[model samples]
Target: MQESRLRWYGHIRRRPPDYDSNLALHLSLPSHRSRGRPKTRWKDVVLNDMSEC
Candidate 1:
């Protein structure tokens, strides 16, 4: 899981997912849905084995 999170952070940073795309694909909802701040802190969100810390 830790390794995967690191890879995912790289992927998201490289591509920098658009909010609309995130909502459509991950949330499976219309673009009009309300949004909130991301769950993870940006630094931890980009790190490896973050949950263990």
Candidate 2:
């Protein structure tokens, strides 16, 4: 699981800056959360794996 996430992360990193998946990682949405705990996002998962290394 971690391996695949890392693979895709590298794949996205190699894309042009304007590519959607690449850009999505850095883009923040204008909307606010409804309430309760925030979701576990894709970047959050990748970051957790990276920190474990």
Candidate 3:
């Protein structure tokens, strides 16, 4: 699943910067303090996979 997701992301990256997928991927939200551990983000997963490669 991770590999396939990353592959799809690669395809999305090839799209123009104005593309919705690219915009969504690069979007960032304001940070806030949470009561518990933070969520596992897609970016984090991709980074881990990249390190493994």
Instruction: Give the poorly placed runs of model 1, Cα more than 4 Å off.
Output: 16-53
Per-residue lDDT of candidate 1, residues 1-53 (tens digit): 66776766556556646755343334433456347864554455545365666
Candidate 2 wrong stretches, greater than 4 Å:
none
Residue 44, model 2: lDDT of: 93
Number of the top lDDT candidate: 2
How accurate locally, in lDDT, is each candidate?
0.54, 0.93, 0.87
Question: Residue by residue across 9-53, what tens digits does model 2's lDDT show?
Answer: 999999999988888999898887879989899999999999998
Q: After superposition, how far is residue 6 of candidate 2 from its true place, in Å?
A: 0.5
What TM-score, computed on C-alpha atoms, does each candidate reach? 0.34, 0.85, 0.82
Arranged by TM-score with the best first, the candidates are 2, 3, 1
lDDT by residue for model 3 (1-53), tens:
87887898789889999989899988999988688998998978987887887
lDDT score of residue 47 within candidate 2: 96
